[model samples]
Target: MTRIIAAVATAALLLTSTSAFAQAAFPTRPNTLQGQAACAGYTVDNYKERFAANSGGPDVQLHSLCAGAYNYYWMYLNAIRKGFSESDCNVTYDAFDKAARVVTNFWAETH
Candidate 1:
């Protein structure tokens, strides 16, 4: 009985700790910006900066940070649309969208 109780407790703890948080996909509404096309000026740079900062300023990325910024921003915006208050939107979407647009514009102009 004692061994069984311990095993059950251990399993319960594992189940609780391993519970995954729901990370929903971004919506396809007009509100969501994709790549450097819709966003041209500020989206890329700002996100790059943020990613670098998060990485302790080494400024390395295995994948495109711009893409991550766009996705993260879109996801948060999705949260707001799902029921977050207008004031609680946290403005992350705007930041990412701005960077994406800037980057897009720069590439378009240069190329």
Candidate 2:
């Protein structure tokens, strides 16, 4: 019984630690979140809203990756004005911004 409790406790600790670390790895920017909400909205929520909104899987994953990438632009520009370059922020935004556009265009064309 003691061993089982210890194992469960260890698992819980590991889960909590990993979860915190995962969230920590994710970028943080209220502005970014706001921007994503805006861009994602198809005037109210995103392209998926009109046809199908996949909250997960490849397309949805792509959407998330792109959203995060797009937000980097605002985050970096703000950080820069505050005196930090935030080079990492720059790449994701620029690349993803264009990709989002292309993806949208592609969808518009195909559908």
Candidate 3:
């Protein structure tokens, strides 16, 4: 009985330690544009709404990532506002997608 209890306690301790290590190892700030990617299928108003949604929350890491995505939306909106062209928005969106992929790869490697 004592051996079993000790084994369980050791397992719990290792689990907690590993979980804490993982949380600490994660980057506090986004390392790639992909981490901030959002608003892909959104219209101008929808994009704005999404940005507003991201404006506040409990998670600081989430807020930072959302801020990056909001910046991407702003670029899309700016192109539209300036009457640049659809291609301009497409370019910005493409960049956002690429950045997101980079971030995804980064996390994959870290894990």
Global local distance difference test of model 3: 0.42
TM-scores of the candidates are: 0.37, 0.31, 0.36
| lDDT scores of the candidates, listed in order | 0.44, 0.41, 0.42
**Top candidate when judged by lDDT against the true structure:** 1
The Cα RMSD in angstroms, rounded to one decimal, for candidate 2 relative to the true structure is: 13.6
Task: Report each candidate's C-alpha RMSD, comma-separated, in the order given.
Answer: 15.3, 13.6, 19.7
lDDT string for model 3 (9-105, tens) is 4433443443221112221232234323332333334545654665665433444434444455455444444444354344555544454554345
Q: Cα deviation in Å at residue 86, candidate 1? A: 1.4
Please give the TM-score that candidate 1 achieves against the real structure: 0.37
Instruction: Tell me how many clashing residue pairs each candidate has.
Output: 14, 5, 2
In candidate 2, list every pair of residues with a backbone clash: 40-46, 41-45, 41-46, 42-45, 42-46
Say which prediction, candidate 1 or candidate 2, comes out ahead on TM-score.
1
lDDT tens digits by residue: candidate 2, 1-111: 344334334433443443221112334332333343324553213433422455555556446544433443443443334333234333334444454565555445544
